[model samples]
Target chain A: MTRDDLDVDPDELYGRLKAYEGRTAASGGTGRDPVNEPMIRHWCEAMGDTNPAYPAVAPPTMLQAWTMGGLAGHPGGSARSEAYDELLALLDDVGCTSVVATDCEQEYPRPLRPGDRVTFDAVIESVSPRKTTRLGTGYFVTTRMNVRAGDGELVGTHRFRILKYAPARPKNAPKPEPAPKPGLTADPARRPRPVINRDNAGFWEGVARHQLLIQRCLDCATPRFPWLPGCGACGSLRWEAFEASGTGTVFSYVVMHHPPFPAFDPPYAVALIELAEGVRMVSGITGVPYDKVRIGMPVELEFLRVDEELELPVFRGAEA
Target chain B: MTARTGDELPPLRIPITRTLIVAGALASRDYQDVHHDAEAAREKGSPDIFMNILTTNGLVGRYITDHFGPRARLRKVAIRLGAPNYPGDEMVLTGQITSVAEGTAEVAVIGKNGIGHHVTGTVTVQLPSDAPGTTDASRTDAPGAIDAPRTDAPRTATTPDTPR
Candidate 1:
C-alpha cells in the first residue's frame, strides 16, 4: 500500500500515542497490564519449556507478554488497533491490496511477572520501497515498540516489519540459499548422551516406566523441570512427580537443514508441544514427513533410546 | 495490643549494568542500537542505550536466585521495568515477605535506581520448609513438567546414500 492510500491521519496517530504515553505515566510506573499466573502459564505452555527455571521462576518470555499491554483499558492502543485491518484499510485507501508480515524481532532485558505495570511507546522506525516479484511493488514499514514499566524502567522492546504490497503476489520469490536451522546440536559420538540432570531425574525415571512425568514443587505447586532441591515457592525442599497423558499439540516448530550434532540428521523437525496437562516441552517430531509439522497439530509422545542409559522423548501424529 | 510475631526478611539488592545488556543481547534479541550501542542510541533520542526489558527480567531472576542460594528453587518472579536504566545506573532490588501459605512464602519485589523505583514485582519461592520425603511426587506429572524421552518410533537405520 502506498502512503497515499492510507486514510489514517497523522494527527490521530499522534493523539493516540500521546494518550497512551499519558496513561502509562499516570499508572505510577506499573505496566498497563498486570502480569498474572494464567498469562505466564500460557507463554510457558506455548514454548514447551519445562525448565524449572521457568515455571519454577517466571520465564523470561512471560515478562514480554506482561509488558505487552492488555487488549483493552491498557497502555497503547496500537496493539489494540486491529493493526492488520487498519493497515489493510490504509492500503486500500492508498490503492494497495495486500500486505504481509515479513519479519519481527523482540529483545528483553528480563522476564515480566505479576504486579509489574508496563507501558509501550511505539514509532514507525522506517518505511522503504522494495522491488516487486510476482506481487506488485511494495513498501516495508518497520515499527519499533519500546516498553517500560510505569516508573519509567526499561522492560523490553520489539521490532515488527510489515510489508505492504499492491495487488499482492500469488507466491513469494524463492531464495537462492536455504534458511538457517535453529537450536544447538552435537556429534553422535561426541554428543553428550542426554543425561538425566538432577533437575530432571524423575522425568527420566518416569520414562523408564513408560509414563511421562513432570516436576512440581511442593512449595508453590508450580510444575517445571531441572528440578531444584527446594521448591521455587517458599523454598520448600519437597517435590512431586506426576504422570502425563503424553498427548499434545505442536505449538511451534522448525526443520533443521544444518545438523548441529552427528546424532541428529539434517531436515529434522523440532517442536514445542503443549501437552494436555497445561505444560509445554521441546522435543523432536518423528513418524511423519517434516513438512507435515504445523502449529496446533495433534501429537503424542514416544521415547527413543538415544544411548544405553538415556531415552529421548519424541512426538508423532496422534491417531484421530 | 496484639503482638507482632514475624521477623521481616532482609531486602535484596541487585546491580544493573552494561554487562547484563550484553548477556541479554547474546541470547538472540533484536530490539536495536539503544540496547548496546551508545552512540547510535544517542542519535535515536535516548539518553543512553537503555537496558532491554528481557535483561531486566533476567537480572531480577538472578537477584532472587543469588540470595536464595543455588539450591533454592525459584518458583515464580515477576517484575515490571519502570524507567530507562542507563549503563551507569545502579539498580537496587528489594523484596519483603507478603505471606506464607502451605510452606510457601510470597515476596513483594521492587527495584530502584536510587533516584526512583525502576521495577516492581513479586516472587513465590519454595523453601526447605516441609519434612524430607513428604513432598508429593505426583505433582511433577504436568505436561512439560520436565524433559522427557521422545515417543516416536525410531526410523529404520539406513545408511545415508551420501558418505560423510
Candidate 2:
C-alpha cells in the first residue's frame, strides 16, 4: 500500500517532515550509570575483546551508553520534542508503520574516564525523502546527539539513523540452491580473495602448496599466525615460516546468514581455529551444520579449491 | 595495526550470532526484544534476531583499538549502519589510514556483510607519542588470505573470523 491509503497531501506531508529537520529530538538527559568498570568488563567479555586499555576508561564505542535511558527510556518527556513524535505519527498515519534501525556513527573527542558523569542533548538531524531498500520502501530518520561530561567536557558526538518503512512483500518460493560444494564457481566478484603482498606472500604460497604455515619470530621464539612481517611482542624482522600441525579446536565461531552475497550461501559457520601450536587463525568450517559448530570442537585443516582460481585453507570437524 | 599514512589497517572478522546479538544488547543495557528474541524480530519484520546499533558501535570500537593496539586512542568514531547484522551473518571490517598529521590519523573504514556494506565511516585516532611506526614492508594481520590490508590499491576484502 502506498500513500493512496492516507488523505495527507504529498507536498504537505513532505513539508511537515522537512520542518522537523533541525528540531530537538531530546535534551538535558542524564545517564543512568556513570562510566564504570563492570559494564566495561561485561561489554569486553561479550565482544571477546580484551585490549588492556579498557576499564580505566570506557570503550570508545560505549560513547552512547553513558546517555541511554535504559529499558524504560528517558526518565520523562522533558527531553523529547513534540515535533519528532508528530513526524513519526504522520509516517504511521500513512501505511509505513514498520521500523528498523539502519546504522549509527559515533565521534569521540575524548575517552570517558571511570568517574566522569555524562549528559546529552539530541536533535532531529534530518529526515530523508521516501526511499526504497531491499526490505521495503521508507524514509530514513537521523538523529544527532552531543554528549558532555560533568565538567562540561565534550566527550563525544553520536549520529544514529533508522529506517521507518513498510516491509517488502515476501516473494514466492524459489528453487533451492545446491549445498556448498568444494568446487563452487561463480563470478569472481562473489568470492573473497586473499590479499597477496610481500609481507605475507609466503603464507599464501604455503597455502597453494597445501601447507599451513605460521610466522615464528627467531628473536623472541614467539609464534604468530596470519603472518605478520615483524613480531609485535619484540620488534624483530628476523622470522621464519613454521609449518602448522593442521589440528586445532574451535575457540569460537559465528554462523553467517545475511547482507547476502552472490554465489554464497547463508547460515554457514565461520570459525576461529586455535591451532595446537597455540596461535589462532580465522577460517571456514564444514562437516557439521552451523548451529552445531561449537567452541572446543576439534577440527583439522583442509585446503579447499573454492573455485578454479582460488584455493583456501578450511577446517573440518574432526569428530562427528 | 600501527602504520604510516596510506596504510591499511588489518581487517577484523566478527561472526554475528544470536548469542552475540543478545549478549551484546544485554551487556550494553539495551533490552529491546528485537535484538534477543527471534519471534520478536520476526514480528518486527526481520528474518530472525538482528544486531542492535549499540552492539555494532561496540564492535566497531573494538575493531579499531584491536588493530591500533591498546594505546591508540579514538578521538572520534563516526559510523553509519547499512545492513542489519542479523544472526548467522559475518561482518568483515576493513579500513585504511586516509591521513596522518599532528599526532592524529584519520582511518576510513567499511564493514561489509555477506551481502554488502553493513557499515561505512571514518575513525580519527589519536596515536600515542611513543607508538611503533610500522613500515609497509610489515603489517600482516588478516586471516588475510582474502583481505590484504588495503594499501594505495583499490582492495575490497578483509580478515577471516571462521575456518569455513
Candidate 3:
C-alpha cells in the first residue's frame, strides 16, 4: 500500500512509543549474568588469540550475554516490563503486526565483568514506514538501549533495528534442508592429538567423553567455556564445570578462505553459535552448503572423529 | 619505551567537556542523563558527563579524515572500550601502522582516558597515493574555458542606462 493509503495518526504513534519507553525505564534491570567467560575463551581460542587482556578484560560485544539475569529470575522488575513485547503490543494497537530484528550496533564505554549489576533503558529512537517487501509492507523501528551500572554509570549502548510488518505474510518461514548426519565410522590410525593449552585443556577433556561442558566462575557463578585462568566476573582464579545441550542457533558465520593452521580445512564455515544455555561458542559448521547458512537457524553439535586420539566438535543443521 | 611497528598506537589527549560529549551523545541518539546531565550524573556517582564510544569513534574518524584529506575512504574500524572518559579527563587516541598494501593502509588504533589505554582496535583506509594528471583535455572542456569572457567579442553595458 502507498503511504497515502495508510491513515495512521502521528500523535497516537508518539504516545504509544513514549509509553514503550516508560515501561522499559520501569523495568529496572534484567539482572541476568552478563558475558559467559568460557565461551569468550573458546572464541578466543578458535581465533588463535594469545592476548592476555581478553579474559582479563572482556570485550564489549561479549558483554551482551551479561543481560540475562532478568530472563533467569521471577517475573518482577525488568522481566515484567518486556520492553520489546510492549512495543510490539503498542504497534499492534496502532494496526501493525509481525516484527523482526534487522540490524544492531553497540558501543561499550567500559568492559563488563562479573558481579557488576547492569540495567538497560531502551527508547524507540525512530520509526519510518517502508514499501512492501517479500514479507509485505510496514514500518521499521530503530530502538536504542542504554545500559548502566547499579550506581548509574554508563556501561554500553545498543541500537537494534526492528521491522514491524503488516499482517499479510506467514509468521514462520519454510524450513531448509536438514544437515547430513554425523558419520559413525572411526579412522583406524591414531594421529597426534592437538595439545590443549593451559586455558582450554579442561574443555577438550570434556569433549573426549562426548559431554559438552561449560566453565563457571566460582566467585560469581557466571558460566563460561574455552577455559581460562581466572573468572571473567570476579577475576578469581577458581572455576567449575557445567554440562550443555549440544544444540544452538547460528548467531553469525563466516567461510574461511585461508587456513591459519594445518588442521583446519579451507572454505569451512565458522559460526558463532548461541547454545541452549544462553552461552555462545565459535565452532565450525559441517555437512551443509555454505550459502545455505542463515542466522538463527537451528543447529546441533556433531563430534567428527579426526583420528583415534582426536575428535573435533562441529555443528550441522538440526533434523525436523 | 620506544614504539614498535605492530605495537598499539600512542594515545591522543582530548579534554572532556559538555560540548564534545553532548555532540557525540546526540549524534548516536544516546540521550542517557548520565552522559549529559552533570547533577543527575553526580547523583548517580559519576563525576561529570562521559563521552559515548560512538562519538569517540566519530571523532577518531574525523581526526583521520583531517590528516588524510577528503578523498580518503575509511574501509573498516574495530575499537574496544576501556575506561570511563569523564569530563576533564584527557582523551587520547593512539594508533600504529599495521600493514600497508598497494592502495590501502591498515592501522591499529586505540583510545586512552589517562588511566590507561581505555579503547583499542584497528582501522583500514584507502588513500590517493598518486597526483592527478591533465592528459585528456580534448575529451572534456578545459578548466576556466567556459567561464572565461571572449576578448574580441563584445564589451557592453558598462552603465545600466546606456545602450550598447
Candidate 4:
C-alpha cells in the first residue's frame, strides 16, 4: 500500500496543527499537593536515593512530580485546554494512536522548600510533521512548562517531548515455539541461563529436582523468594529452604512483544505469581495464551526443561 | 583523587523487574496506564508495559548523585530515550566525566539493556572544588546525614560483561 492508502494527507494535517503552536496547553494549573517531606520521603525511598539533602529542601529534580494528578486524575479535570485535546484527537483519527515520551529537559532555578505551593503554565512549543522513528511513524509534539512557586517566582522550566505514532507492524506474528534441542557451540539464540551463585545456588538445585524452594528465616520464619542472603524480617544470616506447594495465583503479569530476544519468543506472558506461601516469584505463565492470562488466575508450578543444560521453574494455569 | 576530565565513574547493573517498574512510576506520581497496565499497553500497540520517562529521569538522577555525593547539585539534566526498558531485562549504566571546569563537571552517561541503549544523555552536576570524596566527609555530622555518604573513589568495572 502507498502512503496515501493510510488515508492521511500529510500536508493537510501539518497545516491543521500549525494553528496549535503557541497555544496554551495549560494555564494557572495548581499542583495536586504542596511540596512536603512525606512525598519526598516516598520518592526517595522508592528510588533508593538517600541523599542527606532530602526532607530538608525537596530534590530539585522533583519539580514536576508535585504537579501530577494521581489515579483519580486532576481535581479540576486535567487543567489542560480544549485545543490540546483536539490536537491529540486529530492524530488518533489518522491511525497515530501510540504515544511514547522521547525527551525531557528541566532547569531548576531555586530549591523547592517544604510548605511551598506550586502552580504552572504550559504552551505547545511545536509540532513536527509525520516522521518515521525507530519505534514507528509519528509526529513529535513538544510542550514547555513554566513552574512557579506560590510567590510567583519561576522555580523551573521543563521541556517535554512525545511521539504520537502508529506502531510498526511486526514482520511476522509471534508464535510460541518449542525450545531448541540440545546443541553445541554455545547457541546465541538459546534462552539466557539464570545466574546461579553461592547465595542462590540452593534454589537452582531445588529447581533441577522439580521442587520450588522459598527461603525461610530460621529465626523469624519469614519466607522470601528471589532468595536473599539474609532474612529481611529478622535480619538473620541463617536460613533454611521451604519447599513450596507449587500452587499460586497471578498477582500481576505482562506480555513481552518488543525488542525481541533470541532465546525467547514474543507475545509470551511473564507473571509475578504469589505462591500459596505468600511469597511472589517472577516466571513465565504457560498453558494459556498471552491475552488469556489475567491477574488472580490460579496456577501450578512445573519444571520446564528447555534444553539439556537448563531446566526452569514455570507456572501453568488450570486451563492448560 | 579529584574528578578530572577523563575520570570514569563505576558502572552499576540494575535488575529490571515488574516491581521496580511499578514502584518507579508510582514514585514519580505518573498515572499513565502504559507504565503499569500491560493489557492497556498491548491494546495501545506495545507488547508490554514499559518504564516511564519520569522513572528514567529518577534513575539517571540517582546515578549522578550516587557517584558525586549528596552535596553535588544538579544544574541540568537532558536525556533522550531510545529502546524501552521492559521487565525481565537488565540495564547497565556507565558514565565518563567529559569535562570539568569551575566546580562543575559534565558527565556523559549511557544506559544499555539487552536490546540496545535505553537512554543516552549528559548530566551537569556541580561538584565541590576539591573532590566528591572530601566534600562528603565534612557533612558526615549533618542533621539528616541518614547514612554516611559514599566517599570511595569511583571503581571502574574490569569485567563489564559479567552479569550481576
Candidate No. with top DockQ: 2
Better of 1 and 2 by DockQ: 2
Candidate 3 residue-wise lDDT, A153-270, digit = tens: 8887766665576544232423322211112233232535666797888788888888888988888888776677887778988888888889899999987632123344333678
In the range B9-83, model 2's lDDT, one tens digit per residue, is 767767776688888888888877778877665655566677787887777777777666677788877777666
Put the candidates in TM-score order, highest first.
4, 2, 3, 1
Write model 4 residue lDDT over A1-320, tens digit each, in one string.
11222467789889998789999988888888899999899888766677788989887778779888878877868878788889899989987887899888888788898999999999999999778765568889999999999789999899999998876643243522222222223355678878889999999999878899999999998999889999998799989998999999999999875445667655488999999999999999889988789999999999998988999999998763
Candidate 1 global TM-score: 0.31
lDDT of 1: 0.53
The prediction achieving the highest lDDT against the true structure is 4
Per-residue accuracy of model 1 over A1-320 as CA lDDT, tens digit each: 22232334545543433332212111222344465555555544332233455444355444445543333434433343344335445545554555444433455554555666676656565555443433245556666666686467666666655556554322232221211112223223433655558777777778888788877777688876444567655777787888878889998998874313444544468898888877788888878777678888899888977777677778987533
Can you list each candidate's DockQ? 0.02, 0.25, 0.01, 0.20
lDDT of each: 0.53, 0.75, 0.56, 0.79
lDDT (Cα, tens digit) per residue for candidate 3, span B1-164: 11123644333345555566775565344556766887555443334556665555555654343334444445555554445566544555656667766556677665554344445566665544431111332433434222222232222211122110
Native A-B interface contacts kept, per candidate: 0.02, 0.60, 0.00, 0.49
Single-chain TM-score of chain A, each candidate: 0.38, 0.52, 0.41, 0.53
TM-score of each: 0.31, 0.63, 0.33, 0.64
